[model samples]
Target: MASVPSLSASIQQRVADALGADPLLRRSDRADFQANGVLGLAKRNKANPREVAAQVVEALPTGDDDGLIAAIEVSGPGFLNITVSDAAITRTLAARAADDRLGVPLKADPGTTVVDYAQPNVAKEMHVGHLRSSVIGDAITKILEFEGEKVIRRHHIGDWGTQFGMLVQYLIEHPHELDHEAGETAAGEESMSRLDRVYKASRKLFDADEDFKTRSRKRVVDLQAGDPETLALWQRFVDESKIYFYSVYDKLDIAIRDEDIVGESGYNDMLIETCTLLEESGVAVRSNGALCVFFDDIKGKDGEPVPLIVQKADGGFGYAATDLSAIRNRTADLHADTLLYVVDARQALHFKMVFEAARRIGWLTDEVTVKHLPFGTVLGKDGKPLKTREGVSTKLEDLLDEAVQRAAVVIRAKNEELSEEVVAARAAEVGIGAIKYADLSTSLGRDYVFDLDRMVSLTGDTSVYLQYAYARIRSILRKAGDAKPAAHPELPLAPAERALGLLLDEFGNTLAGVAETYEPHKLASYLYSVASALATFYEQCPVLKADTPETVENRLFLADLTGRTLRQGMTLLGIRTPEQL
Candidate 1:
């Protein structure tokens, strides 16, 4: 409704009609566009593929309506090599610019999607794994929301569980352990970070003393049984952990509302009924005193069956049980039409079994789609999982702090006149954007190296590069003050303008593709293309110093439109574009 059908779609429709219902067109690499259905059609009707291709091409209109088709040629094996027209490219861009949503239409049938991500265990340090999950999930949520889907974010923080027992016991002994607020510069310097001190002291006592371990285990039982004293102590641990989590999320520039922090314990009530239903439906069985589901196809390296244990032998519910319960609540209570779990790829098998079990129990049905957007681990330069120099898990706060510092250097170098406060703020956005963009710019299923140098680099597929492109356009538009952007259909477009126009027109289609496939990398790649095209256009066409006033105004309009498109596209990827950087 916003613009005419894309050139690819229009051409496909023409070919489909020519082929009729007998044999349809197919994609071929031999041509820009190909129809391989001729081979199958020939086999069925005793016709040659080349002859069928020729007939289909002839049937395709060679008029103004088919303006996108500069030429339609038949290649070997009956492939249609169609070349699109420059005018068609310019027209689509102009039309897209005229619309409010930039030619991207909302889905007529949108569904409610509940995404569960950013799940960090309480009393434990937030690691790079949690950072990756939060960043990727944020981008996915943005893209889905842009597509008009009702997205409910679930930041399943590990605020509940038995680990709280050890933390609470330790906190009670060291009453002032969890005390802290924002630190001052030179006036206040602490020997240890608040979270570090608490975690270390708790871990030390838990490991060294047998009596402490016994008390911790007992504390867990008490906490589970709703013992008031133990529960109150547990709340302190959860609260302290939240302070640490919020500081990290704040640095990351991600919005994680407190109400969405549904920990595993939130599903405790439903876990019992979930297991009961699973056992009754034969989806799970008691094997070796533990409730589990074994698959014939999934096996260990020793050829033994790999069972998904829903409940431990100690009669305690595990992650599988918690997840199953969450699924039921999401579908029945939350009324979510879709459930998305953006967890690590290492848990793919676990999710696979859980989904199967849920399906068997009728919690997840055809009407409700469930997807596990499992992502790969982030590896260091050594090609192994990222870790600290001492081989410990890298703390997310430390990683983010380093990224922000590095970004400050880049911002200062580019904009020397900026105030310290502005530099810090812009640096945070650029730094966080770089980190997130590094993870999102690649296929989520593949492992990528966490290289700060490459991530914040000024050139090549980085967030800073895109930000610079957007800012540069803004600068040009600002210089051309009072010169409004207006499309001139009668005027012929330059090569750079045509190229930029073609890419801009495909924004809506690209968004739809990214949403349908649950692939943010596609959207990232598309934004990169847009920035690249705009750069080429800027280099070739002068916006503020064109030959004539009208020409300059039209070119400025083009630049303004490009800037808007870039800003919108980058925002969908959860990246911010600084006005001057």
Candidate 2:
């Protein structure tokens, strides 16, 4: 199916052709759209603004039956306030409603993007600090794929380093520490519990026993040297950590494939080569026995240049080496044209240096687009990073559980007759949806309070509001039996109807903006606007009851399209729209 041209786009083109310049058209309260480009066009050509506006308006067609512009007037400073015909709004939306994609067009030139996110360390539990990266990355991935871009997901778990050596040595000595019974697979919680136990016990022994500490240090050398026994034990830790990671992702309603779980160890083989390349190319110089890449703009508090250390003075590689290696693999081997990192805001400097280093080494070039999408912290009510009462980081699983519980209360209070099973199912959708919406609706690099009360509220800008809007439309359509939704181009539209119709036509344009900027909040705001418009439409115009049969059908048609638009938009943001809430 062909994509539908929005009324705004059509008007902009017409006005641009008449003025012979780009019409800076934008939605306005004075009219359906207002063109401000005439002011600039007139100034450049040394003509009166009002005269240019009049000439453009005179060239445009206007009529009640045939013209797209129903009326046009000159506002202050030569602004052209244009009102599009009701038929144009209804006609454009009808085309969108007939298509499965809602007339959203695919990108003409899409490229492969490797998105690195959802990083969790092995032998450590996930906390609220890990929430933004996972949620934001998941939403971006879905949005890009919807735009026909080839997206490659990477979950860079921390499964390597000297810490693993201690874990492997402990398991070797105990021999049964990480072992599970026959025919028994360790669940996510159990896996974490077992790994935690081993970690704590080994740490206590390593700190108190000098001999054990010496042995642990030696084991690191063996592990790095690829000793089979040591490597086998290390694999157990990685496997166990994955079990825990998957469990949390499942609860959050995010899907993560096993193959995409590439951690630091995945690039171990390339670390030495990556460092050698940088040193040979003069991109990195040895400073005090450490291979480093320094930038002029990045300086420490003492005004000394801060150099990104690729390899430590002890001949061990650091994160910079692994990251550069990952860049090489993604661009050269995977043929990716774009690289995205959804990480903490604090890591901005680190990535800045890493990207510059890659550019200097010729791994990242002009042909590749690399971006580091930094996000802010999740604060508590006290304007501090969220933590438990014991001052420990709040666990991700526990936070989700609490959200679901709160959602169940809200769902039950709304409808006492709903079965427990139904309530449970809907609560999961609403609760998780609320968390995701709250995170996604806020602009990036801004901290948000983790308040379940405000999140599950029925009145405000939350997922609950949008979910109810969708459910209400579905109810109207169900009662709309024997009366099918049909577009009536000849029927006059009410103010509310015209408003919704115009907003529905902007769905494709909204998505295009999101894909270009990699922002999910824009899509969230669009859905909220649609819901608000639908609310007004319901209040002003009756769907099942109207003066004429065609009026009722026309309103129903608008309602159906609104519901579909809300569903599609929510889905693109990795949110669910339950039919009944």
Candidate 3:
């Protein structure tokens, strides 16, 4: 089956044809869809509202044969409440079940999209703040790819700066500090520990010893000038940091490729050319011997226009220079139609200035669009930033480990029959799924509390709920054993079945909306609604113990489809649904 038109789409098209304009149809609580266009159309034409509504009802294709709608009633002054045929709902879902992609059509004209996300600073521990970018960006990447759009992932990690000078200089002085003699390749934990020790010692010396500080500053120049030894030591920091980065990413179930790890250093060669081009084009001007782009709306506390400093008077580049260069590369080199930056809300102004500068430079044209999907913070239950008792930023590894540990306890208590090995495996899935779901479920622009108890709860709007809902359906389908799920459109649907079927039919449309808006929360909400609908259906209708054999089979078919749809939606959100969980 080709892509099936939504019931609302079919009705809207029919109503649009009759009205000779858009019908402005929307789903209603009282009916499958309500047409509010009649009142506006009537008031505009100076015609009686009831008469126009009645005329639309007359033109409606609610006939018995080849008709999607079952009833079209003229309600109130000029409103039309429409109910689609029960057969149509089941038929559309059956079409969805038969084909893959959940009946969603790949975009006809997909464009190249370059997504900048999952940024982690080198030689530093990844804190809870990095979670949103990686999880949200991964979901967006999957969703866009599913929509047939060409997507390029950019880690945009921070792997260069003056900090490396301190770290590398200290490592060179203490030759054995970075020695991996224990083994040729050090573990991620060992690498991080070594880096942490070296960084602390180096910082102490730099603060106390003026001579060491001077040498460290000179090492920064040597590193930038491609001094072989200095560059070699700098690479070790990056390499060790990547080892830790990869380990943490693996635990989170997110894939981070080496090639995609384009850090701050990647655009170094382009910085000079980028600044010169901006200066020659007058996009940037020298203010006190420093390149800057000033915005009228952006003013400092001194009532002066705050400029985005591209380069400092000290002959050093800033983040804006690298970002502007990235925009040029993503456009002029990658030929991306859409440039998406999934950064934190705190960096909103930085990106705003950078994008505006890019637009002024003609690097981002009318055909090319750039958007910053700035997300809100993740607060603790205390409504403050999530932190350890020591008042330090919580490490990413500890957070993930604790989630899994808590999930294991929940799993064992819920089902004592499971073996330890099974509990351990399911715990990881449930825990990670819970964490990712909690993040994705909240609207992107709002801050949400991180509560482990609520997240792993078997009840409420948690991933565990969805996971169990799917597991229940899977269990029922398995009990049916040899009997396969086969849709019977001829059979009548119960009210509960009708509700679930209608909601299920909206899955493809819901997914399309999520992909278009770059909002994973919407998809999360949609899955929750489907799960809720399934609960109501399970309560009102019996699958294995229906009144008749055909009734049982039909209900079984519905259960199976619900399971598959739930699995697909969760997978898109980067959550895994275990069959046995």
Candidate 4:
């Protein structure tokens, strides 16, 4: 289906035609929309602002049944306060409601985007620090894909490092430590438990036993040198860690394909070539026997230029080399036009240097768009990073489980007659939805408190509130047994009805803004506005109990469209909207 023109766009075009220029129009409390473009248009043409406004209004068609503008008046400073006809709102939304995408248009020119996110180290438990990247990246991916852009997900996991040497060597000596039947995939928790035990035991041995430490260092060389036995042991660690990673992602309600799990190890083969190219191109210089790329703009606290180390003096690769290699693969091999790194705010400098280095080496060209979507920390109520009482990072799985538990309590209190099975099922959706919404609703660079109470509250700006709004609309429709939603263009609308209808028409525009800016919070705010509008509509205009049959149907049409808009918006944010909550 073709994209439906929003009421705002239709009105803007009409006003622009009259003024012969772009109308700087915006939603206003004075009217349905207020045009401020006349002030600028008049100043440029050396005409009285009010006269220009009157001329524009005189040229606009009004008072006709088929006309878009119901009324147009000159307000303060020549502002044109325009009220669109109720029929226009109804007709536009009816068109939107008929389409699956809610009339959102696909991009005319789309390109492939490689999003690098949800990075977790191997054989380690994911913590709250990993939440934003996964949730934000997942939402951005969904939104981009919805916009008809080819999105490629990359989970640049931390599966390669010196620590892996200790892990592999320990596994070699204690082959039975990670004992499971061949081809058996370890459960998430069980895998973490086994890996944690081995890590701790090996650490103790490596720290106290000098010979063990030396042998562990040798194991790293073997692993890097393509020794089959060493590589096999290393693969075990990667495989076991993947099992754990998938389990956690499953609990979070995020899908991560095995093929997308490209970690540091994936770019190992390209590291040497990456460093060689940089060195040969003079983009990197040998500083202190290490191949480094220095940027004059990037300086340390001492005012010395900070250099990005690509390779150490001992010929060992640093993170810069691996990252540069990943850029080369993503651009040269995968042919991506855009690259997004959903990482922590602290890593901003690291990525800045890496990106500049790639550009210097000609791996990242002018045609490619590279962005580091940095996110703030998740904080406690005391304005500090969230941590367990023991001062350890809070585990991701434990936090999600607790959220589900809290959701169950809220769900049971609201609907006590629901079966335990139903409660459990709804609890997962509600709990996970709450976490995701809370993260996405906040600005990317701002920290948010991890409070489940506020998150699950039904009266506030939370997922539960939006979910209940949807469920309430569904309940109303169910009560209308034989009265299906039908658009009545002739029926006059109440203030609340017009408000809801107009907001529903903006759904497509809202999505376009999100896709352009890579910000999910805008979509979240828009959905909240929609839910708020629906709440007012319920208080002012009864859906199933209106005065006339046409009124009831028209109101039902508005409610149904609002429900669909909320559902579609929430889905784009990677959230769920249950029929009952």
Q: Is candidate 1 or candidate 3 better by TM-score?
A: 3
Q: Give the runs in model 2 whose Cα sits over 4 Å from its true position.
A: 182-186
lDDT of 2 by residue, 1-581 (tens): 88778888999999999999998999999999999999999999999999999999899888754558999999887999999998888888889999999999898899999999999999999999899999999999999999999999999999999988788888889989887868986589888889899999999998899988888999999988999999988998988888999999988999999999999999999999999899999999999999999999989999999999999999999999999999999999999999999998999999999999999888999999999999988999999999999999999999999999999999999999999999999999999999999999998888999999999988789999999999999999999989989999888899999999999999999999998898899999999999999999999998898888999999999999999999999988778899987
The residue-by-residue lDDT of candidate 1 on 378-422, one tens digit each, is 889999999999998898878888988999999899879999999
Sliding window of 10 residues with minimal summed lDDT for model 1: 184-193
Worst 10 residues of 3 by lDDT: 178-187
Instruction: Write candidate 3's Cα lDDT for 1-581 as tens digits.
Output: 47877777778888899988788899899988998998888989999999999998887778485548888899899888988888888888888888887687888899999999999998898999999999999999999998899999999999889988888899889988866765456567887888788889999999999999999999999988889999899998899888889989888989999988888999999999999999999999999999999999999899999999999999899999999999988999999999999999999999999999998989989999789999988899999989999999889888899999999999999889999999989998999999999999988888889899999999999999999999999999889866777788888889999999988888878978988899999999999999999999999998888897778888988998899999999999999899987
Which of 2 and 4 is ahead in lDDT?
A: 2
Order of quality (lDDT): 2, 4, 3, 1
Candidate 4, run of 10 with poorest lDDT: 60-69
Error of 3 at 320 (Å): 0.3
Error of 2 at 442 (Å): 0.7
User: lDDT: which candidate is best?
Assistant: 2
Q: What shift in Å separates residue 494 of candidate 2 from its native position after superposition?
A: 0.8
lDDT of each: 0.81, 0.93, 0.90, 0.92
- Superposed by TM-score, candidate 4 places the C-alpha of residue 204 at a distance from the truth, in angstroms, of 1.1
Model 4, backbone clash pairs (residues 3+ apart or across chains), number: 0
Instruction: Give the per-residue lDDT digits (tens) of candidate 4, residues 1-581.
Output: 99889999999999999999888999999999999999888899999999999999889889684468899999988999999997788788888888988898999899999999999999888999999999999999999999999999999999888888899989989999988768875689889999999999999999999999999999999989989999888999888888999999999999999999999999999898888899999999999999999998999899999999999999899999999999999999899999999999999999999999888878888999999999999998888999999999999999999999999999999999999999999999999999999999999999999999999989889999999999999999999988889998887888988888888888888888998889999999999999999999999887788888888888888889899999988998989999987
